[model samples]
Target: MRILFRLVAAVATVLVGQTAVAEPLTLIIARAVAVPDSVSGQAMLSLKLTPDSGKAFARFTGANVGNIVDLSINGAVVTSPRIAEPIRGGEIMVSGTFKPGEVERIAERISAGDAKVEVDVKSE
Candidate 1:
């Protein structure tokens, strides 16, 4: 299964203009729900890590306190927010200026269990 978890955007390397530029780490996430943004009053996507994944997330966030966490959609970085506290509840709110129909697509993909573990071989 693809590893998906909330992350504090740690500085990393990216080759740009023949130079290694520091870039925000791509935060792979599991499931997110589409909703209205609370602050901006715009479109938003709320995320909640799965049970098993949440445990690991708590531990990671606990260790990496006071860092910026990034959110990505379709392999593109959308938001990078700082960790205010340890996310024990596994709930995250993602709000951004998205293109048309982007929020619906994310919700659909998650609801359809796109992030779940895939089985290549079936056993009868």
Candidate 2:
């Protein structure tokens, strides 16, 4: 099963002074892995996007600095992180209070493309 992810680019419009009519961009995940945190030794989920999605993400973040980007999974909002700067890299690390086993399971599911992920950039 392939997970479909949508990135709403509302902040892009605000940055460029354009109308908020841009369609959401779809981002594809290349892979996900559970790795141990270097400092805390806790499990962490790492997500790598496909090349095209990475470029799209970089552009979106570059245009939306200081904006909040909401991340959703399975139609439920999970995290809303502020874009401090452009993320040119294709990798993202998700760290939380998840147990080791839980993180592993989540990583496996994501890597197998069994979850739907969405990112929404809202204008402040």
Candidate 3:
């Protein structure tokens, strides 16, 4: 019975490995800013984009105005919302259902300048 179980597990692992893997989520961010919430005065983190990336995002949004874009962190999809308009200025406000530690982790990465978004001041 032990040998049979091992054989089954091996076959299952092989099959799983043969299956296709989904592409990881990618984000275009220039920097992240931590600020206070307006209502509750809690801490809030905002994602910003660099100038070049902002131009690219504007083009993409223009092309896919009605399409949904996935907002992710660490390859996990946090929200998939439809694009309402062209995203100019390259700033994204993250507000939604976020696990307590999840936002903290994101903030830590952003503060460390290790997140996918480039850390830079927006050129006005």
Candidate 4:
């Protein structure tokens, strides 16, 4: 009986190991162009992330996955706090707020082509 229990435990462990809840997510910066429309309220830019596959319940352990998000631009960058939410398949919704003149600032950065964005993600 003890041997049987041990075998069962081993099998369970193997199965669990094979199916980790977390996976590396690719954050591709789509377009960081500036928007000067008042309706959008400034500091607005078009952006996107790719290959988003993971379970929200699982933590973002830095062990398996290295970094969280990476940002690269050819122009200015407007800093703000962005939020990502799970979408259809392998996608997430990312939005944030920026400074009043954030859009113009980003434009200048991109024009200079010396600005790149990088973000880090780790286990909670």
The top-ranked prediction according to lDDT is 2
lDDT of 2 by residue, 19-122 (tens): 33223455588988888999989887788999999998788778777778776666655567887998988888877677449878876777788887667775
Candidate 4 Cα lDDT to native: 0.42
Instruction: Check candidate 4 and list the clashing pairs.
Output: 71-117, 74-110, 75-109, 75-110, 75-111, 76-106, 76-109, 76-110, 77-106
Give me the runs in candidate 1 sitting further than 4 Å from their true place.
1-31, 115-124
Which scores higher on TM-score, 2 or 3? 2
Can you write out model 1's per-residue Cα lDDT over 25-116, one digit (the tens) per residue? Answer: 22334676788766776778777767766666666556545666555555555666665776787666767778878877877776666643
Q: For model 4, where is the 10-residue window of minimal lDDT?
A: 74-83
**Can you write out model 3's per-residue Cα lDDT over 62-112, one digit (the tens) per residue?**
655666666656555555667688778877776666656566778778667
Kindly report which residue pairs in candidate 2 clash with one another: none
Cα deviation at 8, candidate 1, in Å, is: 31
Candidate 2 Cα misplacement greater than 4 A, ranges: 1-25, 122-124
Report the number of the highest-TM-score candidate: 2
Full candidate order by lDDT, most accurate first: 2, 3, 1, 4
Better of 3 and 4 by lDDT: 3
Clashing residue pairs, backbone N/CA/C < 3 A, model 3: 30-49, 30-118
Cα lDDT of model 4 by residue, 17-111, tens digit: 87233443333433346654466554555443333322321233323343233222432222322224322242222235666766567656644
Error of 2 at 70 (Å): 1.5
Model 3 earns a TM-score of: 0.60
Superposed model 4: Cα runs more than 4 Å off:
1-30, 36-40, 48-95, 110-112
Q: In candidate 1, how many Å is residue 104 off?
A: 1.4
